[model samples]
Target: MYLVGKFEHSVNAVQLSALLDITYKTAWRMLNKIRSVLSMESQQIWGEYIEVKHEIFNQQALLSDDRLQKERSVAIIKSVKRDENNCSSSFFAFQLLSRRKQAREVLEHSEQAEILIRLNLGGHSSVDMNPRFQQFQKRNTAGDLVNSGKRTCHPLSVIASNAFSWMKDKFHGIGDKYAQQYMDEYCLRLNASTGAITCAFEHTASLSLQMKH
Candidate 1:
């Protein structure tokens, strides 16, 4: 049932329940389990000319007293590699800040450096030498990354915007608690054409076998 339609169109609990002829609770649990497996499978270490940017979901709520609980700050990292013909292909990863963490603090220069170190643990050159990293560092402030005056509609921005729209349209806007899981689902779906579904199934089977032992 999960593999039913185009991979881009996610199967929500309501749709899954109707398709599988099961109770909503059961369908929700099953979908969550699948999303959990996908999240685990998608935890990849990115390298080679990585580009990092911040995207905020629910921007209108950023100034609210309970903004920390309502606003979601995500770091979108794109890793690009060039082929023999100088053609480039990109892979993406998304990381969300903890509910209590603010974007400005967590997406700052130091934090971005930490993320780069983690992604390039294979001991690539100093991140400072990376032009993409330099571009990120040149930003006046982390806050500007999230609340920039000019909203250029770049590819990464379009992906982030689509993610927000997907969540709002499919699930009627997810809460902070399970937002990351939904983000994982979206990432997996985005990469589905690149054999991500096979990887997710393999991870799911491995997890099931481990549980049996």
Candidate 2:
């Protein structure tokens, strides 16, 4: 609770152990179990106009050759009704994909038209631009739609940048296996918006209660 909610940060086993006056193994087990409850598994997300972005990060390991590179994709979905009111409420989904095939499969599963993709100027776009996906009509000009004299508004890109910055500032760096858990935590924060710290505490406590029963 203190490490995750109070500090709004992530700590490795050793750091957690020292902070909590517990053994390293005990801290590791505790953190992993808590992360399990926060996992966003099998959730379905849909949107009329969606923004998708991908970023790759490198994590360090003990051995010189043990470093690994991982890619994460973020999709921000805007609801049609909110767009009409000029107040867009964004819903997001995230996946940790290491291969192009995995990335393609996830995008196919979402399957929304009027999609705005944000990529580095020369970066590889793993999204398949199939005619079928493009055929679906746009309900609102929401994501990435720039108005006259306004700079392009890529909401997902902003979200991704902030998310990555938060992770780095709080946790330093995360492992590939636990990457999704951190992403899920941030998504929960985004959804809650206000009173996010309280929301995180409530969520973890609720899941803990369920496990005991």
Candidate 3:
């Protein structure tokens, strides 16, 4: 629970092992179990006005084939809400995309009928895009396909950049297989409030009991 509360600061298995006087393997397993639980908790359907940005992570690719094998595609989703005072707040979620799926599934199955999608059409030419996503780009030629050059300093972008940097600095770098779990952990920490740690502790304890039974 302590380690999960400090997720925003980045905690690795090595550090947890040293702190708990346990083997690295045990610490790693414990950490991943927590991440897996958080990932399950993050699967809620999002509605209302949401912004989706497709980004390529891990390695830079100069060619299409290299991108398919070496890089990972992720959708950074930001859902905005307003209070009675008209102050805006945002919550974020991430979905790792496979080469065959791309953002087509996300667009097609969205709960909202009119969603505002903002694509960062910068260095993503090498990505193996879904045919439907390509058609979406072609159909929405009225300024929906945003150029990366006109980027603004949005909070969502900052959170995404920080997540990459945190993983690099702490875990050195994560593989594509476990990337979604790490992203889930990051989003959990980002969206957590003051009482969130207590809630996490209760939830973890419940899960532990269920597993034992």
Candidate 4:
């Protein structure tokens, strides 16, 4: 009952521990296991139109009195509409010491054009393609495709926005290291809504990741 309830909502380890009347360590372990499954399930989802966007969060170190003196900021990458119908989304969080290179690095590596080309070649129609994405689809030049993902990537889907809001409310603040895990959990929930929740559970169970007691 606890696991199922937790799956339905976003609750951090501390809150989950208090809710279940269990030790914090045990709660953390259980949440980690579940998050692992969610991450695995997200990896299995493939799509053509992936919108990569970044969200900025304030670092804990900058919360104190020294807030004005070059406050540190962290950015996380989130991808939405992995499939043609915009049914799935995925998120990734990366740590950066320098903010100057964050946007450039994301654009250089995400390969939005490559994903679109491969999917279009594979015969999947893009669902919510931006104008730039359409241009990439029509053109074959490497220069046109490269560095275009940054501009073509749209904002988050409605479901993704809701999930992020839910996570933010539940956790108060998210850390850089575990942002991916939390994002995966939200993705699983969003994906499960397309069909039956049982199927999502079954899919996670099929993965060979060993779980603890």
Candidate 5:
């Protein structure tokens, strides 16, 4: 649910089964079970600064054999704004940091200002895109996309793709419930690409020490 769900596209049990290398019947049974479990309410974790990307795959895409698929995936780099930090930017910038200094300095505004404004005001969803979504896209976000804007290389899509690429590689496939788990891990990694991991480990160590005062 997380990867495709974050993108807000529905996946059938059969497709989930193939992706996860499980039986079709098993996938169908598990999907219902998991959805029932998740019917309870949930809270949203707002991303104060984000580089959100959305991709779409039609039904045919999901149903086709991997080698036979021909559907297109559109990656949107929506609201790539950054917050004045040591917090948001620390993670945002770290993700953008490159082999050279130029990459570090590039997209400074796009990351902090333009992207931020859009996410806060624009509101993106599946299928029909927000006008704001089109703004500062590959064409406008110069620093972020190399080889010119000829390619649609939005940050959100790029990061998500990399994460999914890893998941597909490691697990070969994911059942719907399991797919959701992997997606959660991906979101946490993306959202926590900064100090949360370190802060968490440090907190654990501090608790273990029983610090004096």
Candidate 6:
């Protein structure tokens, strides 16, 4: 709890054990089991909106003669707030987007998503390009990415930024291996806006049940 509180984070094996006063290993096992349900295997493929996001990840490991490049994982999330007065009681729909041309092509082949998102709704997109990669040897914020904008940022950027903020606040930092699962679960939680805890809980429980059986 001490360590976690320092980071203003939640949903992790460390805190779970401390709260229950259980063994570290036992807590780890339990956390892993529950967290597994949130993994990619549980990602609901609705074929609903394509080109929203999650299109950025489709890279393959390259055979290296000598060159090793760093991999970048960028997911753009868009959301719409459900109002006090609306047809749908809750939810702000979000979409995962991609930037690589090849990624888009594969997405098109798989889901036929070109009309819904308008693909290039935001001008000067980061998708559809191949840049030389680099490797990191240490832990330090990339100065190149530290933005000092005048009026915060663009709308799409705001939405994308907000999604991650919500994820980190509610679920803590999602490690590389379990990120998708965490992401899926987080998306599910935010799907129903205006604080529908009951609905989110039921839906997540249903998902867990399905995964178990």
How do the predictions measure up, each by TM-score?
0.69, 0.55, 0.63, 0.51, 0.37, 0.46
Q: Which pairs clash (backbone N, Cα, C closer than 3 Å) in model 1?
A: none
lDDT of 3 by residue, 1-213 (tens): 656755457578998999899999999998998777655542222323556665555645355654546766566776555557776555566777655543233334332222222233222222222212221231233544465333344445566678877777778899988898888777766655422233445555555565658
lDDT tens digits by residue: candidate 5, 93-173: 111111122211224434434433433424433212221222234443544644346555455545546655655665565
- CA RMSD per model (angstroms): 6.4, 9.6, 8.9, 9.5, 14.1, 10.6
Report clash pairs, candidate 5. Answer: 5-8, 19-173, 20-173, 20-174, 79-115, 80-115, 81-115, 81-116, 82-111, 82-112
TM-score of decoy 6: 0.46
Tens digit of per-residue lDDT, candidate 2, span 1-213 = 445544445566788999889999999898877777765322223334433444333422342322332343334332221445566454554545445443323454333232332212122233323212111222334533333333543445566567767777777777667877777667666654533224556766776676778
Which tens-of-lDDT digit does each residue in 1-213 have in candidate 1? 234224457788888899889999998998887666544532343435766677776555436566645666677766665657776556666666543465433455566666556555335542332212111222233434454453435566678778888888889988877887788777765654544244544544664455558
lDDT of each: 0.60, 0.50, 0.58, 0.46, 0.39, 0.42
Alpha-carbon deviation at 191 in model 3, angstroms = 1.2
By TM-score, who's the top model here? Answer: 1
Itemize residue pairs with steric clashes in candidate 4. 47-82
CA lDDT for candidate 2: 0.50
How big is the positional error of residue 66 in model 3, measured in Å on the Cα after superposition? 3.2
Task: Compare the candidates by lDDT and give the number of the best one.
Answer: 1
In angstroms, how far off is 58's CA in candidate 1?
2.5
Error of 3 at 212 (Å): 9.1
Clash pairs detected, candidate 2: none
Model 6 score (lDDT): 0.42
* Tens-digit lDDT string for candidate 4 (1-46): 2353336775678977998899999988888776765544332244
